[model samples]
Target: MAKELQKLFEDLKREMKQEFRELKESFERELRKDVRDIKASMSFINQCYEEMKASVKKVEAENEALKESISTLKEEREALYAQVKEQESRLMQNEQHSRCLNVEIKGVPR
Candidate 1:
């Protein structure tokens, strides 16, 4: 009977060890899969980051070009305004000179 009990205990211990080994293998496989997924996600995120940086650079260049264009337009507008003012002043002077040359006699017959 004692020998039989020893044999049974050894058999149970072997089965338990086998189960534990299987569980360890399953855990390692799951860990490896999770690591692979994390790596893929990180790679995708990095690619997006690079693309966004390139886009920002392009937008910044465009913004600078627009600013220069606006500055040039503003300069042109000011120059045109000054020219218009000068022309108005000349017209007023000509009108005043012309009025002095006009003689109106209402009572005399033509």
Candidate 2:
């Protein structure tokens, strides 16, 4: 009976060692998987950061283009204003010339 008890204890110890090894292996596998997941998540975050930076750059470029366009529009407006002023002066000169001709014609016999 003593020998049987010793055998049974030895078997139980072997089984427990096997179970412990299996648990250790499972824990290591899960740890490796979690590490891989973290790495993938970090990579995705980096990609998103890069994309956001590019988008910011694009927006900045657009803003600069808009500033240039606004400046050009302002210049065009000034040019148009100058043209309108010149046309107005020409019209006034033409009106004065027409009135002078009419007065001269009426002073003459017809």
Candidate 3:
């Protein structure tokens, strides 16, 4: 009877060991799947970051080009303003000379 009891206990221990090994294997598989998912997510985030960096560069280039265009336009406007002022001065001088000439002609008496 003692031998039978010992054999029964040994069988129970072996069964429990087998069950523990199966549980450990299942846990390892789950952990590996989770790690793979995290890696994939990290890769996707890196890709997004690269795309955003490129987009920012493109926008900055466009902004610089726009600033240059605005500067050129401002220079052209200043030149036009200067030309207009010069023409106004010349017209005023011509008008004054014409008035002086008219007065001289009248005084001379044709």
Candidate 4:
């Protein structure tokens, strides 16, 4: 009976060791999968960052171009204003000369 009990205990110990090994292997596999997922996530985040950086650079360039265009338009507007003033002065002089030429004598009957 003692021999039988010793054999049963040995069998139980072997089964327990096998179960522990399986559990350890499963844990390691899950850990490796988690690491791979993390790496993939990090790579995606880096790609997004690069795209955003490029977009920012493009917008900055466009902003500078717009500023230059605005400056050119401002200069043109100033020039047009000067032209309008010169034309107005010429028209006033012509009107004054015409008025002087058409003066009437007060005693003349129509």
Alpha-carbon error at 31 in model 1, in Å?
1.4
Candidate 2 residue lDDT tens string, 1-110? 99999999999999999999999999999999999999999999999999999999999999999999999999999999999999999999999998885733355665
- On the 0 to 100 scale, the lDDT of residue 56 in model 3 is 100
Q: What is the lDDT of residue 86 in candidate 4?
A: 100
Error of 1 at 59 (Å): 2.0
Q: Return the TM-score for each candidate structure.
A: 0.77, 0.74, 0.79, 0.73
List ranges where model 2 is wrong by over 4 Å: 104-110
Give candidate 4's whole-model lDDT.
Answer: 0.97
User: Which residues of candidate 1, in runs, are more than 4 Å off?
Assistant: 98-102, 108-110
Lowest summed lDDT over 10 consecutive residues: which window, candidate 3? 101-110
lDDT of each: 0.99, 0.97, 0.96, 0.97
Q: Model 2, 48: alpha-carbon shift in Å? A: 2.9
Q: Which candidate is the best by TM-score?
A: 3
State the TM-score for model 2: 0.74
Query: Candidate 4 — which residues are off by over 4 angstroms?
Result: 1-17, 105-110
The residue-by-residue lDDT of candidate 3 on 37-107, one tens digit each, is 99999999999999999999999999999999999999999999999999999999999988875733355
lDDT of 1 at 20: 99
Reference-based TM-score, model 3? 0.79
Off by over 4 Å in 3: 103-110
RMSD, model 3, all Cα superposed? Answer: 4.1
